[model samples]
Target: MKRQTHQLVLAILADLEVYLKTELDNVVIYDDGRGNEDVFFRITEKEHLPLVASLVKKYNGRLVTLTPNVIDDETHELVYHFDIEGLLINCTITVTDKKIPSITPILKSADWTEREMKDLFGVVPEGHPNPKRLILDESLAEGVFQEYIGLSDAMAGAATNKLWEHINEAKRKRD
Candidate 1:
């Protein structure tokens, strides 16, 4: 049953590729050696992200999460995970100019995660209805996580502890 469902999803994705006139790179079913399989594909063009989101919704798939990984100083990768008929699909889009189209308009559940990618990774989600910071203060610079990568473990821990202290103080004042 799992194999058949996976094949059906692949067929739909192939149809989408043909309809969109775009190629999906690294289209494969990855097995985790633990009786789990996930369908993964990469969208080389960032513009196609929203269109894919719309199609996923039309097919009754729900957005699971959006994860962003910094590739280099000027490049990032955004992976949009979805669950369709109990099969997990991971659609990845590469960002070169630190900007990508927001899928929140198509999937409202993507709102907070998109904002989080913006705040933590500095990847701006253009067209997001509410593009405000989700986890970090506006006063602090964006991509705080990236900035701490070069720091020593102790230094990073200290910085994180200090930031948490500041956050706690603010919460106390608000209360």
Candidate 2:
């Protein structure tokens, strides 16, 4: 049954490749060795995210989660995880300008996750219905986490001060 499900997912991805009129990059299938498999692939273009979401919906898949990771000062990666008929599929897209087309418009479940991503990573989800702060206060700067991650101790010293300033300001507002 697991083999059949994996084959079905591969076929669906193949169809997606055809629909996009190009081949997908970094495609990998990992079997957890415990009767479960995960399909991972790179979307290659930010504009194609909506199309990918639509295709996943067509296959009756539910968006499981969306995660944003900072690759460097200028690059961010968004990973969209989905579950289709009990199979896990992960699609990743690289964003260079800190903006990517939002999937919230297509999948309502993505609304909060997109907002959280915006607040944490400073990656604007273009076209998100409600792009307001979700997990971070407005007083805190967007992408606060991005600034601190992977920083040298010297650089972190500056970031730490800035973070404390924001925290102190937020605290004062409540008093």
Question: How does candidate 2 score on lDDT?
Answer: 0.83
Error of 2 at 96 (Å): 0.8
Write down the TM-score of every candidate. 0.78, 0.80
lDDT of 2 by residue, 51-97 (tens): 88888888877789998888998898889998888888899888899
Q: Which residue segments of model 1 deviate by more than 4 Å?
A: 1-3, 31-36, 149-175
What RMSD, rounded to one decimal, does every model reach?
6.4, 5.4
**For each candidate, what is the lDDT?**
0.81, 0.83
Query: In angstroms, how far off is 132's CA in candidate 1?
Result: 1.3
The TM-score between candidate 2 and the true structure equals 0.80
lDDT of 2 at 29: 89
Q: In candidate 1, what are the lDDT values of residues 31-150, reduced to their tens digit?
A: 766546688888787777878888888778778999888788888878899877777889888889998989898898889998998888888989999988889987877887675454
